[model samples]
Target: MRHFIAVSAIALAAGSAGAQEIAQADSDWYKAGQERIQAELAKTQNTNKARNVILFVADGNGVASNYMNRLYAGQMEGGMGDDYVQPQEAFPYLALVKTYNINAQTPDSAPTAGAMNTGVKQRFNLINLGENAIHGDCAKVSGNELTLFSELMTEAGKSVGAVTTARLTHATPAAVYAKTANRNWEDSVPEGCTAQADIATQMIDAMEAGTLDVALGGGARYFVPKGMGTPNGGTGHRPDDVNLIDRAKGLGIQFVHDKAGLDAAADNAPILGFWSDSHASYEADRPETEPSLADMTAKAIEALSTNENGFYLEIEAGRVDHANHATNAKRAMIDGKAFADAVALADEMTDDADTLIIVTADHEHAVAMNGYCGRGTPIDGLCFDVAKQGIEHSDELVLADDGKPFTVVGYLNGASSVMVKQDDGRFTAPDGRPEITQEQAQDLDYNQQVLIPKDSESHSGVDVALYAKGPWAHLFDGTIEQNVIFHVMNYATNAN
Candidate 1:
């Protein structure tokens, strides 16, 4: 077994900073530090009323996740990854957000996103319902339904939309409008809950009732019946035999299933689009036919900015969470980069003076950055020894007590256990950790080593960071409960 103290020693030894060998009076770092302070002092608070609000959620992107993303992105651009700054990191104001649900310390998606959509915390597995509502019980949903931020903005005559790299009815996106006792009720309800509308139907109902102006993402199976085939070469999953896609068509909503369709959509018409049968492809595996997260975000802004009363849109980089659960660090960081690209495009398209652009995460994961490697280290590769006197890394690898190299990024526990399975189907641990090569660890499909075995990675009980710009961004000064996100939006928009 590995000792925590040994791991800490490795990190401390490799990451220890040396005393300055050069004069600090004229160094660029010293001057730049002063310049940054002056820039901050020059910034005046913006008190203008928000005309548009774009809430960007990179699901499962906690502080650690964001740090890893920054390093990966910097290395990709030929820099010492540690010093690179993401677009959201340039935001004028920020706060640390507590993400625990009412019933769980290690939070899940449904309640965390619900806490941001509604100004209160609820039990685990519930979405946009009060704390009194019982999870999985439809009867308790009637009076306990919470009014969502999207709903209030819609009632104020503002255009509303939701865009994600996930199913439109997934928890993070669903929190935009749908109110249900259970987040799992997307296309089908339980036996006793058949009287209630599923999440997919609720999305359509919002569009039909003029509450949602645009809807985009994957999960086409939920819109049609079991016998109906989706454009993505999959059959539907709806148990009720009702085709919600056709229902949207009958209601005059323009439905699209590909990038070409999304690009050619009439600017004046409301749109309902799905890029795949299930969740959209991961950023690295995405095909030309599917629109990127940035593409969908641009289309959403184009459609929603037309309303004079303004708009509210929710965009999610949902695949980051999925990849983390699978313990795939490369895909997770790739998706994280794509998410940052979307945020950049959104910021560029809208004026920060009048549009409140918020970037946050619903929760954190159990991912860890280990072996305090040298600067410019390949984030997804095996950890290398720190440089003795130069800024660049050394050629030698950092071996553990077992004389085996480990990755810089790894999960505390995940599917990739140290144990191997025998022909008899029983799992067994080897005498020592396996030897890992740099090339093998750097491969796109490599899974980092794990200490504890689990079918999937779990969420961490940690705080996530929130970045904001535009109206009332300064209000996010100190640390806050997750629910304060909703109140900040409500204050910026002045929506009752």
Candidate 2:
């Protein structure tokens, strides 16, 4: 029940001109909230002593997604129940994180994830290379610089690992290991650039250096040959006939492509598992195609925990951001719940006293929950009242032109009555009924369609929540900058 707010000086300065007017409008509420935040921060005490750290990034997750997941879970349990039934509710320590890039009004994943991974603020597209990154030439950037994972592993003699649903070369995952000027230069050369250091190359380097123990999740395409079919039959290729899997094997790293392969690999061998070419599918969508995030987390822990020195692992639920970008609240919530499930699994597998677990998001999406639709609302409930003829529901719900419900989520930019069924096995909005759809929803233009002022279903400048458990959890009370996560993890792992 303790709440805290930490607004930046920039926000405060921006509001100063109109501060008197706003104070007159909501003076009591604002002052009360501020007082409450201060009191909460003052009462917080740091007493945790963690030896290992596991960080989970629910890419674009925000406060709204957290609450919505709780509400959906509560509704599933007959409503008015505790939101704690959702996995995130189990964490005892929480904080608010300020997510903003050094240069952009709206931040991207590169710098946002980099801030958490390195504890330094850099230009928007620069990864772990830090602020010294040149716009076009990433090779010139000094990347051997310390990452939280690298620093921890070196200081504690612990192993390090990174897992994600997206390509291991993607921004979130790469921030933990690879450094580059641009995020999109996965395995490909950057435009007009000579040196190319994709995430796969970095993983191999880490493996060779004996610092990284586990590297899991998609982007087999960057590790294998083009002719070879990916784990999913798609092409998995590297440009120079460089089979990263072979390179990993040359370094005595165990490479696995499927669940069975992972299961059969030697327990003590360092692992490099690439299950897909790109991001892995959602649990509900590709239940059989790939391993769930929970499965991957369990495997990573199993592989790393064997080291006598402990380990640092970063697990990302990257698809949650994709779902949010599409304005699919149900999908986002479901995926978010699954991500939390991975955290719970990690909590159970590792000793809470020795393992530090941190759950947070890079940024927030512009998804907001309006008034509730009333209890006992059928799965196929009508989104709007029939009596209000010609009055459309908010543009948040994705409907079909034929009136068949395709998706329950809608976007803020595009106008589409075409309903597309979600691949996930969830409820779907029924025609003319206020029902939720089984398919994920899309983001819509809140301004043009719903008369809401948001331009696109874009990332918000609002603060995000950080939930932690295990040792050092108490340090997370109150509000802090997104980069503080690196310091917390470093402290927990005894990394300098």
Candidate 3:
């Protein structure tokens, strides 16, 4: 539990003169502080049963990534970005979640998301399976399958849905219903692993069994047989002749391939939409043929709300992870903003009294924000010199030890290394950091400089932030194990 001290009371306790001075100070900052404290003090926790749950996950969105996104979003709105408030940041309850897998320190999306969905820490690269299950061995997975919140919600008569910017069979979203020993078994498994079904097959099985009411995302190829052409100008990836797209249609699921199809989908029918052959385009590069994260969120809510038992939906901005891995800060921040927009739309669509909305990340990335740059510095551009007088930035740019300007945002290790690969296949460091101009650094295609050389940046073993509101939200306070999120959701809905 936490307690708050009134602003005036604290000042008066200091001294009468100090209290009078503080009260007389009518600056906007002072007034804003007082008003915020009052709002906090007046807030009352909702203890009712959570009729609905919407888990909004931004994959690889760690604390540092979130800070960078905030500044970028604020600057995009024509303001100094530090003070900008994202929609989830305004939630009444928050907690720092320790994201570690049972077998690994720095976790990947599979076990981390599995922890949230199944209420237990799991092995690396595994989906909703018990710790005893081997990563790719199917023989040990039979009784070790863990129950996910999606299953529980469906059993309780609630409508269940999942939407992501990544493939529906991707690790994070697959945790919603999949029970597999390996995350990579999306459309096919390795040789000799015949006992365990692929993730896409499991999802379709759930939908066929009436467990999943809505499914939308990018991996159209996984659902169709090889040699089959998709609406996105790409062919399918499945090795077998099983065309899951046709099977979905035969099951009476409303299948949509483009934004137009999604728009015309029947209001009361089950929906399965695939907007891209692979992961959807980064929010900044999205085309008119595809819907935004917010659009998918709105459609999911509308389709599920008709159920009297309410719904459980998981919405993931999975492209943020891809951008971070490639050290593309611009696309990462844009996708993050798109995620915030989806959260805002979901909040507006449901009543807080009956809905439990949780906004969090499955894991943090190695991307970091560096330098003591001045206020209003372009988050995706080079760091600038600080202004000594006011909130505005100085005209000069900050230079690195190499006498060249560096970006405000960069990855700890990624594709943009100073070392170059030679014809002999040896990576050799040439000279110092490359000369980076502000215009070049701010380009949409820019890859931020990295210290270590790797094909892709890695996930960081750090605590990610979780923001929640509505029923039982107060239970999420201070620091907690990532798996506790599942327990909190379970208790909130079942306790009543």
Instruction: Write the candidate numbers in order of decreasing TM-score.
Output: 3, 1, 2
Which pairs in model 1 have colliding backbones? none
Q: Write the per-residue lDDT of candidate 3 for residues 1-496, one digit (tens) a residue.
A: 1235576566644543464456555777776866786788889989999999999999999899999888888988999999999999999999999999999999999999999999999999999899899988888888898988988998999999999999999999899989899899999987777677899999999998777889999999998889999767899999988989889989999999888898888768799999999999999999998999999999999999989899999999999999999999999999999999999999999999999999999989998787879989999998998999988889889988879889999888988987778789987776767899999999999999998899998989999999999999999999999999999999888866
Question: Against the unseen true structure, what C-alpha lDDT does each candidate score?
Answer: 0.90, 0.69, 0.91
lDDT of 2 by residue, 335-395 (tens): 7777878988998898876888898989887665433333323222223222223422333
Q: Model 1 RMSD to the real structure?
A: 7.5
In model 2, the runs with Cα more than 4 Å from the true position are 1-48, 78-84, 143-148, 191-196, 375-411, 414-457
Which predicted model would earn the best lDDT?
A: 3
Task: Identify the candidate with maximal TM-score.
Answer: 3
Query: Model 1: residues >4 Å from true position, as ranges?
Result: 1-23, 421-428
RMSD of each: 7.5, 10.4, 2.8
Clashes of 1: 0
On a 0 to 100 scale, what is the lDDT of residue 352 in model 2? 75
Clashes of each: 0, 34, 0
